[model samples]
Target: MAPVASPTLLARLLLAVAFAAAGVAAWAEHRADLARRAEGAAFAKRYSIDVRRPSFVETAKAEATGDLAYMPLVDAAVQDAMGTVALANLEPSARKAWIESAQELTAELAAARGLSLSGLAARPGWAYHAELLAFLTYTGDRRTAPVDLTAKSARWELPARMATRLSPGDDATWGFLAGAYLETWPRLPERTTAQALPILQRAFEDPDFVRRGFGAAVAYLGVEPAARLLPKTPDALRTARDIVGKRDVPAAARLHAIWETVERETREKDLARLEELAERGDVPGRRRTAEYWLVKHPPGEFDDENGRREVGRLVEAWPEGSHGPWPRDPRAQLVQHLLAGRLASVRGTALARLGNQLTGVPDSVRARLLLAAGDRYGWERILLESGGVGSFDWTRFFTELAARELAAGDAEKAEEALSRIARPARTECDVLLVRRAVAREAGKTAEEREAEAGLALAVEDRFGAERFAGGRTVSPCVDPERWADAALLVKVASPGVSLVGYGWDGGRIGTTLVSGEATLAVPLSGLSGRRSFSIATLAGPEARASEGWVTTSTGVRGDQPEAAQAAPLPPPPAP
Candidate 1:
């Protein structure tokens, strides 16, 4: 052979070359690591206070401000729901107590330097007013819906007295409060053409009202025989659609009530509307029947105004003997339907409000979103999707929630999170597969980690191709998606050892290999140009290894002498 180069220099050259290649790799790995860290960091940085903690006397701070007279109305509506006619002992006292409280609050509300049914409308702080009104509208006594008839006289006099100071639609919060309250006034619905007429007329005309208010006004009018006079009154669907046009209503929830009504029809096909009507034997049948009715009736296309009013009247006209789910919460019932995903509009409204608050809909609502979401998944999905994560502290969000459960602590939550993060891989064999092929390949520095996090690399089998057990496995070491080529890895360590699995694209699926290691070469076929990769791992000894996943993209690994499977041989014959 020709004179060989100096071993030291040659080694140096080879090492320099190897290091150069590795440096590129290290940089990529470094960046990727940084990226994962960043995501964790960013999520961590945007902290949120945990709301699940036990109530403390020290935190008696008010959650929201601005005009909030309607809040009690909504709470009263919910409480009123307990009055379903089916009560064993109809608490006449409870009814009287509730009505009395409502009437008192009404008196407080009747006059205003600038207050009305829409007390919170002028100030956005009272968006909940719409829902409160919506709730009360459905729950309030249809026949006796008019607050004490005598109280009507007092309310009427005050509206006129407060008329000049009464805010116009320009003051949205103000108008909504005034107009909304007035719009629902049943003081003399028979006298809809006179007396309390201006309030109703004004409530509907005011543009400041949320489209929800429009639906409310339409529904309210539908109950009065005289509502037939508003020649321009649109149907419920059209009203919702028109309000949708205002661009004021959130787009996602625009037809939520409408859509649910559509779905409710199909979902509750087998469900009956009344227990007595269903001829069912169970006692809960009454509640179920009421629930079913809520599901069955939804405002549809063109049925908007009158349709809504009809539902209200149906509740109003329910047979007096048909108690139990009784004194029906026409409005609360509808919201229940909406919440149950029966009525799209109602459900949409609930989802939107909770979603907003969870995502930082401020003041009082934000603090109680979890309470509102009530540990429901759909609510959580909406909460997560809306960039709301940034609003709360991830640490507190995850940790504090743990404190309440007697079984869990904050550290336990962290452990749980880690467990959740590691849960996908099915078997230690699978974990080892990723570990041997991916994790052990190279080391990374901080600078390189930052650089690679942002770059785009073609990663095949990135999500494991939805295959059952084989193919490229996922790298738990990284976030988002990172995969590796499982074939080219050479199992140097025992089946128990783990190694870095390299994908043709350079991305890898890594975990710990408790005992084995699979050294691998850069997969050239499936990988091309700039790419990212990770060494492998098996999670940990104590933790059961979960199943693994691969990238969504299929990699084109060139035909090469692939490593044989490192299956464990059957144990030696007894002893």
Candidate 2:
């Protein structure tokens, strides 16, 4: 302007100005976007619902049937929430502006549809309640709220307000309110059967309860309280009968009814209904109780003579197509097992021998049942009468025997039982483990001790922690030098570490707390077989491997010794 600048210079100057303005606008917009994201994250954390993705709006819209009333309200509410999140990082004036505008739009949209966040219970129609329910689910997590919402009252007020409107014909409301009541009841200060039972009963008595899929919610909410308040009363019994009849009622509830009826009425006429439920062969749990009851109190058909005949018939008619005790047709096997237990009560040891003679009973199954009965003599007889080991499930037989021996503190016997597994699943690992266990219990040969030194070194390579310390213990099963070195390695590597070791059946053997470098021994000697070892560090991230520090190793140990060892001697003589 001062000199009527050349055209080219003027054009260049205007271009620079335009770029500078664009840069400032872009920077401001980027910051605003970042603030919104932060607010969205905060919102989700506080409410347990996400709004940033925006796909929720479409899902809600799709769920809307006749009209899209819920969708608009949902959209408005989400936008207002987004605005609130965006304003969190802005200046005070900007934040105030956003709040006023968002609240105004959201309140207007809510009011236009006769919706009131504060008065959601009074809202008309299932759609309004559904809308409120969905919204509350998204925004009800108050713990992470940036501002205090306590003055606004609790979110639970909505469901509490809607409880009075629950009716039989209103399937949606009935289901929603009943479910809400069950969830909210326990957390309330003065929950009682007086207030909750009526609502549940109303839902339960509804003709639509079963067909409309409300039976589960109603039965679960009703049965326990009904039973507790008026147990064995005619009304309670009637309710129980109704609940048990419903195919949708939970097994626990049905069992409760069966037991309540049996305990209250001693007459076979009343107990006969339960017998019918048992014979139906549909609900195994119910059938088991019924059959046991019939056995205890011989009814018209199940008298002592009939009971014995029934047992004989079941045994004689053993399904030939069945391969194992567990057959697709459980009736034959179930009846037999039940009869075996019942007969034992009367015949004692004789019944077990008879059970062994049954055609369908597997040797392992018979042995376990006899062992459970404390009939070791009978169990041994079954073993002797059993099919050849080649045809039998050797793994199951040996494992069960080992567990029984171990439980009785007979580690030597347990090892012996474990050694009998032909063509063992884990060759080297199982043999070494058994050898170590046997050597630990009894005395080890000098050669065995030396061989263990090689094992200890290999263990350090395969199973040792990243860092450890060294120490010594007098163990005849292991060389002193090797033991000391291995102990020291563990001490150094496992400082401030916690180790959990699990046995074969996934039971925790023990937890080791390491304060310094290491301790010479971990309490995981006897519990070895298909084991798992896990390490957790109290402090420091590098303590755990990238994948995880927990490792599971499946090998035969503590029960099978290597064939290379000095000629094995009858499983080291069971203790």
Candidate 3:
């Protein structure tokens, strides 16, 4: 029988069997897909969402870049379709229904991912419940519309309190209450405002609420009432100042009463009082003083006499020690460095004085001082001499020096500096850009000066570092490495390697695997005044590694300004 059946016939039979099995598997997969689609459609209809839209996918995937408005769509849909008159205010009948539906949806999603609703709430589900509560309380409708003042005062309070109650400590809670509180301000009924003022005032007394939702409360109370309600007595002001100094109070709302006191007493220009506040060890006080000084004496106001006075003031205020007792506030550090730079410009002995003054300062801060003074050689010297204190990066220093030279109309000097950067053709798109610029400025023949525009574009295309690198006629440097805490987008070529983030002090932050794109948002509160961060890729067998950093100032509410991003550095030059 084996001899009778040819090997070809046997091979064909096996192939036919495999195809039949594949057909059955494909049919099964298609049916399962249809079932999922049907279920998704039914859910979308129940919630009034267009599931076919790209936004729905973004919402479902819970992308950080997804529209905030889409976050509440599902809950809003359910509320609109199934919500009753009393449900709008989240009365017991409405509350129960909303919670049940929310919990059901959350549970379904969690089950799919082998998690619970609370676990999901800690991640993606946060936007749903938190935003829903914010929407219902803020607008009293599916969309952000005018609140019906006729509704009972308790109706709005129910959802506002429930937001925190549901998702405390999550970004969703803080973000939702932020919007909710702002909305409540304009629509707060006369009766509710009177009844709730004391409650809101008490809430602000807690450092937690102040950190999380004080801005909204301030908005809700209106400036005058908020000022009146905030601590006013000397002792109370000291205590309140302490809270603000801790950055527990929202930056704008922290010193409302103290500000009112300052404004009433000095029309907001009481530099003497502001300096006294700074002397009292208040961070916000230092910030306020720096801001006022910036306004009073903008960048071009630097002069010999003023520079001397400012330098003297900074030296006295910010004496150096073994990393002890230095003014840790970023704003203070900046003002001090700015004065140092001005002093360096005016006085030949400024570098000597600054070196003495900045002894024992943090490496990053010292780096800033050299950068500010435009002392490229000084920076280079520091980088070479300092064995472990973290030196100024050569590429950055050269890039800046070249730009300054170009700006000063010294094309030769600029070309020299640009030429100093190693492997300029491949290492940095900016370096190549500068090289082309210098060549053009030097009036080289078109053939001799061939602008490596194609090479720069290829590098940008390969690394996706265009945003940080391209279109720079000058230094194009994002300065002052310290940044407010915010999300950072990390893009890598492949998966598996563990990416680690670090705080300003070089402390290891949370880690994630680089499966392509990841967003890292570290809390600046614990980071204190040090907002700079570094990201490193830990190499493994399956990993592709690149190590680099970017800096930014911290944002309001600890938001990171857009500049706090790390672009992929160019790969190593071929051997």
How does each model score on TM-score?
Answer: 0.18, 0.27, 0.29
Q: In candidate 2, what are the lDDT values of residues 1-575, reduced to their tens digit?
A: 37688899999999999999999998886675455334433433233233332454345335423123334444445455544465567678655655555445533333323323322332345445544553444243332341322233234334433534533355445444444455445443354434555655555444444333233444455545444433343333444435543432333334444553554354344355554554564455544444454344332122233344444333332222223233433343443444422332233333344344346666676666576557888778977877755333555546656656766878778777766666543233334445455556546566356436545643432233222211211112222232332211112233233321211121122223333333222222233333233333322111332111111121213222121122222211122
Model 1 ranges off by over 4 Å: 1-166, 169-254, 257-575
The models' CA-based lDDT, in order, is 0.34, 0.41, 0.43
Predicted candidate 1 versus true structure: per-residue lDDT over 81-158, tens digit per residue: 434333344366544444444444333222221222434444433344443443343233222445542344333333
Query: Which residue window of length 10 is worst by lDDT in model 2?
Result: 545-554
Among all candidates shown, the one with the greatest TM-score: 3
lDDT of 2 at 381: 91
What are the per-model C-alpha RMSD values against the true structure? 37.7, 26.0, 27.6
Instruction: In angstroms, give how far residue 37 of model 3 lies from its true place.
Output: 76
In model 3, which residue pairs have backbone atoms overlapping below 3 Å?
483-552, 483-553, 483-554, 484-553, 484-554
Backbone clashes, each candidate: 102, 25, 5
Q: Model 1 has how many clashing residue pairs?
A: 102
Under the 3 Å rule for N, CA and C atoms, how many clashes does model 3 have? 5
